[model samples]
Structures are given as C-alpha cells and as structure tokens.
Target: MRKYALLISLLIIISAINLNAQDDNEKQLLKQFHSITSEEMSGWLEKLCSPEFNGRLSGTPEFVASAEWVASKLKEWNIKPAGDNNSYFQWFKWPYTIINETGSLTLNLRLSDGSVIRKNYQYPNDFYPGMNSGSGEITAEVVFVGFGVTAPELNYDDYKGIDVKGKIVLMNRDVPHTDPRNPEYKKWVAYCYHQYKLENAVRHGAAGMLYVDGASANPNITYDPSIIVCGIGPQPLEDIFAGIKTTNKALIEKIRASFKPASFNTGKVMTIKANTTRVNEGRACNVIGYIEGTDPVLKNEVILIGGHLDAVGNAGRVVNGALDNGSGVVDIMGAAKALAQSEIKTKRSIAFIFIGGEEVGLIGSKVYTANPSFPVGKSVVFINLDMVGNGTGFYVSAGSSYKEYLKYFEQANAKYIHRPMRTAAPEAGEYYGRPRSDEVVFRTAGFRTMAMWTTEATKKVYYHLPGDDTDAVTIDIMEDVAKMIYLALTEMANDPEIKF
Candidate 1:
C-alpha cells in the first residue's frame, strides 16, 4: 500500500512539473508576441498605404513595387525567399477587363404620337455599365420582370409565362423580404444570389438587362457577361416609365409587399447602345518567404500566413485601402517578424505570402495553389488576415470541419488575447463563407484554412472607399489583432499532432 502511494505521489509530482513547464513556455511566447509593437506595424502600414503605392492595383507598376518592398522586408527579417527561381516573387498573369471612359448608355423611347424621344444617361450617376458588360447595341421592346428570381423548388418563378425573347428586360435589384418561419425561406436565400438572377434573365432569351435599384434591392450586384447589364438609378427608371400606365413606385410597392411576380409590357420600344473598351492588364505576383522549422519530419509540413497586397485601382481618385488590406498586409508582416525574431522554434515551417490581385478576385492565391512553390498537399493550415483594423474584438472563421484547428485560436484568445472571439462556420453566410477572402482558394483546394478579422461591420464602413486611408485604420485594434494571430501561429506551428 505504501509503494502504491509513493507511485501515485511521483505521478502527481511529474504532472505538476509538466504543467509548470507549459506555463513558462506560454509566458515566453506571449512576451515574444508582444515584441511586435504598434509602431512596427504602423510603420509598415504607412509605407504600404502611402500615395507612392498608387493603391497597389494588381498587374500595375505600383503593385509590383509593393511586392518588391514586402520581399525586402522579409529579407531583413532573415526569412528565406520561398518563391520561384530562388526569389521572393511567384509571378503569374492576372488578366482582367476594365471599363473605360468610352462606355455610354442611351435610351430611346418611341412615343404614341409617332415621335421618338432620346435621352442619354450619364456614367456613374444615372446609370453605370456592368464590369462584365459587352460592347453591344440593342433596340427592342421593353418588358418589366420583378426581382428576376426563379425557384422551381419553392414553386416561385418570376419568369413564368413571360416571353422576354430578344427583348430588353428591366428587373428590380433585390429579393423580397422573407419570413424566417416560412418553409421557402431557405430556398429564397439560396437563389437570391446575383448570378442566379442573371442566369434566369439569360435563360429567358433576353437581349439586354437593366437593373432598377429599388429600396429593397441590393445596390451592389455582380455583373453578368452573357448580356449587357446596366444599373439604372431610381430617377432614370421613373423617367423610363413616364408614359406607361403603371408607375415605378406602385410596381415596387406591390413587389415588396407580396414577393410575387409583377410582369408587364410597356408599349415603349427601348433602345440601348453601350460601348466599352476592354483592357487586359497582364501579370501580378505573390511575395513568399519562409522560416525553417527545427524538427526535420515536421518541417516538411507548412503553415501559410497571408494577406492580399492589392486594392481597388485608382478611380479618378486614389483609394489608399489602408483598412481594406493595408492593415491586413501589416498584420501578416507583424506575425512574420515576431515569429522570425523569437528563439521559439516551431516544429513546422511558416510561410508568409503577400498576394496580389485579391481585390479583383482570389486570383493571386488561386494562382499560387495551382502552381505552388511548396507542395500544397503538405500545407497543414492557412491563416488569412484581411480588414483587421477596426472594432473591439476578433472574428475567427474556419468552418465546422476545422473545429480542431479552431480550438487553438480559442485557447490562444483565452490565454493571451482575452478578447471576444466569434467562432463561425463557412455556412454562417457572407460573414464566414468561402467568398470572404484568399482563404477561400486554399479551403477549396482541400486544405484546412482560417480567416481572422478585427470586425466585419465596423471595417466595412471604409472598405473600398476613397477615405480608406491611413487615418481610417485603428492602430491599437490592429496591434491587438497582430498579437492574437502571432500567438495563434506560434501555437499551431509548434503542435505536432494537429491534423488537417
């Protein structure tokens, strides 16, 4: 019995010693993470968001300069270049179409008095051509289609019994308000995407589409290249329906209230002519650097830390994008610096990637995944930082499938950050969905991925606006986020048993 008690006491002593060692290791890591200061992060952000960068538009000289600068910083941190040809740049072509000033929209109406009236709408105010709009001219009868949604599963079809063949169809920009208690709510939400609406319009054999922005419609809709899609403001739409029996206001009210089809043919022959110049901007790069791990076996595994370095190009005025992604770039830089300088050696290699062309699409990250410098299958996890410059706390989204990886973040937040952490699955809607950021590309490639942001709502106020400059970023909030991510990366890189 005495021998048994001694054995039990020994086990307890060993457990206490192990716990003490862990506590010490955590304290050491926290101290190293705190070494990444606000000033350090802000200095990098100032340069990244500076006027010299010219908004860091992808496939432009300004964007290339930003990439080179990031590579230089990684070199300064003693991080090895992890790009093609022994350099820090993974170069790839990023082709896209840009609408030039030559684009114009004109509406012609044939009056009952045998007279024709023509009115030209100004760009960006009365109407704006879609991003994917093709250069075309169409003169056809105008048909009104409400909401432009068609769902056979819910027994709701907006295009039902409507012959829109070879005619210009006018549609409201939004889906109707759905009651959560209704059985069709889920179906309504799923089919409410702009692509579905455009597909419905094309499927109905419409020659062109003009989206009227109603109070209930989504103002910012994705463009469909299948036909010429243009956005008509409320005033322009009202003018288009001036001679028609039904008023725009009346039709909008009916559609909003009932969520039913409101289709009609105005005896107005509409003519739409649009001329757009498509410019193909060539290639952009992803800046990559790595810190080798201590353990040989685990070093084969990789942890990806990245943020997009591109912003919406200059639109008459500079869009600094300080908070949109400048903050994100600095966040990753801060993490890289913290990890590289610390004595703490992770078991797995860490790669810092500053991706380009993220504003246009997930092009940079997708290109990397398609032709990666490091084996993508060997990637253990990806941490994407974007718009982490506002709000009080952090939002960690990894989807439910990555709950095991998310626990590291939860534990880190509890121990080091002590900030509110919102754990969200990808299906939690736009907030945590695959459409959010570069993490989407990695996640789609079957790699475990996580995204961290300071706040979604607060950061969006300056998201892509011209006012998204250095002054818009909340430095203190960004500092906290940087620390949180640094700690999380350290913990994840050190853990050996974590499986994707």
Candidate 2:
C-alpha cells in the first residue's frame, strides 16, 4: 500500500509540472501570450548591459560570464545542444584589445651629417596616430605616396616604383575633391582607395602612413558626419572617409617636403616602453542552441535564427546598450523559454545562434556559415533580429527565394501582433549589401535568410550609443515582437508543407 501511494504521488507531481508548463504557453490577449514581456527583456538588458556586467567586453571575464549565463538559461528552457561536440558555443578567436595610450609622438630628424633634430607633438592635441597597426620605432626618409593607391583599373599605382618598404608613406585622403560622382577624383573608384592603401601598404611592406591635412581639394570640407564613428577598429573611420572625395589633395601633396622627416617613436611599440597587443590570433563564434523537431521526415532539417551578438564596446559602458542589442539578446532568451513550453511539436529543428565579433566586421557569422554546427545546405531559413524598435511596426527583409515565406510571416504578425510589422521582397541595399548584421553571413552561403530590424535611421537616438539602456525599452513592445516571432516560428516549424 505504501509503495503504491509513493508511485501515485510521483505521477501526480510530474503531471502537475507538465500542466503548469502548458499553462505558461497558452495563447491569450496582448498581455497573455508574451509572458516574456518587453519588461522582462528590458530588465534582463539592464542587468546584462549594466556596469556590473563590465560592459560585456567580448573575450573578457565579463564576456565569458555573460555567455555562461545565456547557456545556462537555454538549458533551463530545456533546449538541447545539437552539435556533435555537444557544446552550444563554437568559439573562435580574433585579434583585439582595449585602447591604452600614453602620449604624443616625437620625430627625430637626422641630417646627412648625422646631427639630429627633435620634433614632437602633444598627442591628438597636435596629431593622431592613424589607425595603422604599430611597428617598432624607425628613423627613415618619408616619401609622398599619392592617394596611397595601387588600383590597376584606372592605371593608378601610387606605390609604383616607390620603395615605401621601410619608410613612411605620406598620402592624401580619398580624393582632392568637390564631387561625389567626380570622374577625375575617381568617385567610381574612390571607395577602393582606402582598401587599396591598406593592401598596398601591407604588400609593399610600408612601415606606416601619415595623412597630412589639406589633402582635400575642397578647403572647407570638414569631416563627413554621415560616416559611422564606432570604436571597433578601422571600418568606422574608413567608412567616414570613404565618402570623402577630395580634401585639398593639392595642399597635402605640397606639404610633403615640409613633413620635417622626424623619427616617429609614437604609439605602443618596442621602444615606447608600453605593452602592445593585437588580435594576433582570434576566430569567430556562433553562439548556438536549439529546440528539436518532432516530425520524422523533417527532423533532420533545421531552422536557424541568429544575431550578431557583438558590439564596439567603446560607446560609454553606459551605452550599456539597453536597446542596441541587450533587447535582442533578451528577446532570443525569452523566446527560447516560451517555445520550449509550446505544445506544438516542430517538424524541423530550430536553432538560436548568437554570434560574436560582429562590430569588428562580420567575423563571427562568416565563420559560422563556413563551419556550422548543423548542415548549412539543409537549413530552411535563417531569421535574424537586429536593433528592433519599441512598439512601432517593424520590417523584414528576406532572401530572394523566401518571398512566399516572408508573406506568411507578415500575415502572422498582422493577425496576432498589435504592432505593425511589414515585409518586403528581398533585394539589395537596405536588405542586402549593407553590413548591418550577421544575416549576411548565412545569406552569402546560399541559405534562405531574413533580417528583421527596427529599420536603421528609424531607431531611437540611443540605438548605438551608451545611453541605449533598459530604461528606454518598453516591455509592451517586446511582448508584441515576441508574439510575432513565436507565431512565425511555430507556423514554420510545424508546417511540413513549407517549401522554398
């Protein structure tokens, strides 16, 4: 009698737990289905992007801790690791570091007679170290390398016959210019100059580059505000100057003789007596976890949802990013939990991948596509959420092949979601070429992918700044977005009838 009672009690407890889980997932009004409200997202973002999380600097102790927390949460939601390795995080490395500087640079000029003259500046106060990586101190003559280019297209080769192998190359900015579509200024080929410069500089073994102002042909041309100013690395700066057609190029070229050939022992180098580190070795990682499928035929196929979970941490720690990404992060986590409780059994697998090293470039996602935990070709769709906005309607831009599925998603959002989320046929520009998020990586590999964003230039001012904290996110908005995402996932996951 005692044994039977114990068995009955155990069965009762198991049934109660299952019932509670079902209750949590039951669909309801605006406030009901999204038990994981925007409030929860905001709250989680507040905690994760908080100073206590040490800004979640990628690769730091804080970053690792954050990863652990995320993985733990996924496990709690009952999601299982699908990788053969049995781990969710596919870790990769990239060269990186926090900026630490001491002072300005001094140029020691030595005449043919061996006599030396010392010239130095008080740092950015006088001059700034161009984003070129540092090399040890050197003393050599400087040469004017026009535009620092080596483009064979326009028959331009600034590095031609120039032995910039060890000496510094003095070059002008993009072009001397007054025209965006200037033919002479190489507007068409203008954008290639920056990369051409770096590639040529690295190829010819140039020590460094110095951009003496007055390069622009336009004397009044100030820095371009349209250019992004993120702290990740050189991309932001390059993007800013990419549009700079001319900056008094003639003046910069003329100043070549006046560079005063001093020895630059500036920045972190061997003789500078400071520590210098590089992302000397780093790889990308696609943070991954999945809720499995139940259908026999589609069980092997997978549906992956992802986000570039990295940022340029230089935006004040306070840009603790309540919205930039903390909101997205919270969105994924909350969705994982809610879906785990859904009575709907997916016919195909569903993966939630958070990628790292996005801010530095598309480093993480690119790697994941190249080496995915699951087969990339078998993937039916890649859903990416980046910088979603408050309760306002949203937009989804998908691959050329996924137009039909995109319509379905739009319909679902319209039906259950209070916010208006629109869908567009995948094309270029806003949907494609732009390097806004990790979706590009999957798309490049020929996977059917869709990017859902609040739409750039449409977000709050704090979107990319340090002020992007939890206080700015509305829980109600999150709930709505969550419902839409949940609805789409369920429809796609269970619909064995879904085709390209």
Candidate 3:
C-alpha cells in the first residue's frame, strides 16, 4: 500500500510541475505582448489620423503616404516585405465615380387625358446619383416590379412574366415584408442588397432601375455600374404613383401581408438621364509584411492579420477616422511589433497587411483576394481589427463561427485582461448584401475570418463623422485589445492542431 501511495504522489508532482511550466510560459508571452505599450499605439494613431494624412482616402497621395508609413513601421520591426516586386506594396488600380454638379434627374409622367405632368427632382434631396451609375438617357414606359427579387429557389420571382425590356423598372428597397422578429428577417435583409436587385433588373433586360425607399431601406444606397440605377425619395416616389389606383402605402402593405410578386405597368411613360464622371485614379496598394515560421511543413500555411487603412476622405471637414479604422491600423501595428520583437517563433507564417480602399467599398480586400500575394487556399485563418479602440471591452464579430479561435481569447482574458466579451451574431452587420468592412471579403474568399472591435453602439455617435478624431479612442482600451490580439496570435501560431 505504501508503494502505491508513493507512485500516486509522484504522478501528482509531475502534473503540477507541467502545469507550472505552462503557467510560466503564458506569463512570458503576456510580458512580450505588453512590450507594445499604450504610448506607442497612441503615437502611431496620432500620426495616421492627423490632418496631414487628409483622411487617407484611397487612390490619393495621402493614402499612399499612409501605406508608406505603415511599411516603414513594419521594416523597423524587422518584418520582411511580403508584397509584389520585393516591396511592401501590392498595387492595383480602382475605378472611382464622382457626381458632378451637372448631374440631374427629371421625371415626366404622361397622363391618359393627353396632358403631361413634369417634375424635376433636385439633387441629394429628392434623389442622388448612384456611385456606379453610367451616363445615359432613357424615355420609356415604367414598370412596377415588387422588391426586384429573382429567387427561383424560394419560388418567388418578381419578373415572372412581365416584359421589362427597354423600360424603367421601379422597385422597393427590401424583400417582401416579414416580421422583424422572425429568424429569416436577417437573411432577407442580406438578400435585399442593391447588387441582387440590380442583377435581377439586368437579367430582365430593363433599360433603367429605380429603387423606392422602403420602411427599412437605407437612405444612402450605392450600387455597381451595370445599368443606370437610381434612388428616388418617398416624396418623388409618391408623385410617380399619384394617379395610379394603388398608392405606395397600399402597395407596400399588400406585399408585406403576402410575400408575392406585385408586378404591374404604371401606364405612365418616364424619362431618366444620369450623367456622372468616372476617374481611374491610377492604383492604391495593400501594404504587406511577413514573419516566416520555424516549422518546415506548417510554414507553408499562413495566418493573415489585417486592418483597413483608408477613411471617407473629407465631408466639409477632416474626417480623421481615429476610431473608424485609424485605431484598427494601430492595433495591427501593435500586434506586428509585439510578435516581431518577441523570441517566440510561430509554427505557421504570419502576414500583416494594411488594406486600402475599404472605405469606398472593400475594394482593396476584394482585389487582394482576387490576386493574393500567397495562395488563399493555404491560408489557415484571418484576423481583422477594425474600430478596436472605442469602447471598454472587446467583441468578436462572427464569434460563433470560430469557437476554437475564441478559446485563446477566453484564456487570455482570464489571465491578463479581464475585459468582458460581448457577443454579436455573425449576421449583425451584414445587410443589403454588403459587409461592414474588409473582413467580409476574406470570409467570402473561404477563409475563417474573425473581426475584433469594441462595443459599437457605445461609440457610434462619432463613428463616420468628422468628430471621429483621436479623442474617441481610449488608449487603455486599445492597449488591452492589442494584448488580447497578441495572446490569440501567439496561441494560434504555436498550436498545430488548429486547422483552416
């Protein structure tokens, strides 16, 4: 009996020693993460969000300069350039559109009584030109296609038998009305993006598409340049449906009550002419740097860390975008600095990228996914940091999809920072078929993407406004976030069992 007891005691001692060793290793990692201080993050944020950067609009000199600054910082940390031509920039051109002052929209409805009612809609108030609208003119009969959805899977087709060829089609903003509390409501919202609607219109050979604002529609909407697509406000839409027997309110209620196609001819001929200028402002770049892994086999795979480096330029004042994405850029820089300076060597390669043209519509990330520096199929995971310095705690967008990734964060939170984790549904920010940031691009590219940010509701008052300056970013919160990111990256880099 004494011999058995001695053996049991030995086993317990061995286990305790192993646990202690693991705890010591975790402590060392935490110390390395702390090497990226709040002061360094603050300094980086100040420089990136300053007025001299001119809000870092993509395709502009200011934006390129910001990318250069990020490349310089990466070089300082001894991170090797992972971009094209042995440089830190993966350059690509993007098409941009600007609404010139000459842009106008005129609606004329011919009455059956041999008289015509003409109305000229003012710019911005009544209607605004779509960012991707092509310059053209069309005068044809208008067709009312409900919701403009062509979902054959759902047995719901708005253009089932209606011939919309060479005629303007007016449609509502969202899918046929469903209860907001229903689980399918979010899915419907996702499907109701302008792209789907425009595609539907194009498939039906419509000459032009006009979107009427529904109850839940976004006031500001933009779409790709396929055909001439335009948005008409409620007042102008009401004017268009004035003499028709069915009112806009009645039509909306009818469609909402029953999820069915409400297609009809307006019996009124209308004219729509859209003229805008397209500027191909050369090319912008995604700045990339790498820290190669030690393990021979696993080094072939990559873990991507990225943040957008562009903002909404100027809105009569400098949109410093300190909290929008300036904070996110600094957070990535902090992670890069921490990992580069530490002695810990990852098992898989880690790539740091600052994506440009995110503000305009995730253009940079889309371009990268299309033409990647490395094979996207070999990418193990993607971690996106956007607006991370706003609130007190951290929240992972799409947390449910990456429960394994969240385990490291949970462990790190328990040991180092006890900040509470806020839960956000994966479909929260996805609406109108558009992702809220660059993370969506990676997610669509088949990468397991995770986006970390602060409590957005608490900091949304200054989110995209001119007031989103340095004052909106909390330094301590940013530091804590940086540490959490570092902990997660270290854990991911060391663990070989984690798969794509």
Give the candidate number with the greatest lDDT.
3
lDDT (Cα, tens digit) per residue for candidate 1, span 356-411: 87776677888888887678778887778888787777888875687778888788
Worst 10 residues of 1 by lDDT: 213-222
* lDDT agreement with native, every candidate: 0.75, 0.56, 0.76
Between candidates 1 and 3, name the one with more favorable TM-score. 1
By TM-score, highest first, what's the ranking? 1, 3, 2
List clash counts for every candidate, in order.
Answer: 1, 29, 1
The predicted structure with the larger TM-score, 2 or 3, is 3
How well does candidate 2 match the true structure in TM-score terms? 0.67
The list of candidate 1 runs beyond 4 A from truth reads 1-31, 98-129, 132-276, 425-436, 456-460
TM-score of each: 0.73, 0.67, 0.69
Range of the 10 consecutive residues with the lowest summed lDDT in candidate 2: 216-225
Cα lDDT tens digits for candidate 2, 360-473: 556667778888877877788888777664446678787777787786578677677645566776652232123445776677777788877663333354544445566666
Give lDDT tens digits, candidate 3, residues 1-500. 99999999999999999999889877778678769799989999999887778777676677788899999999999999989898999997855544443255576766679788787876555664554566677777789998888877677788988999989898876787465567666656655766677777887899887777421112123444546766676766777787788876688788778877888998666666767565676367899999898999888888898988887654235667888789888888888889888777788889998998887668888888888877978887778888888777788765356667667777778887898787453643444455766787888887778788887445554655567788878888888888887887888888978843
Supply candidate 2's per-residue lDDT for 424.
78
TM-score, cand. 3: 0.69
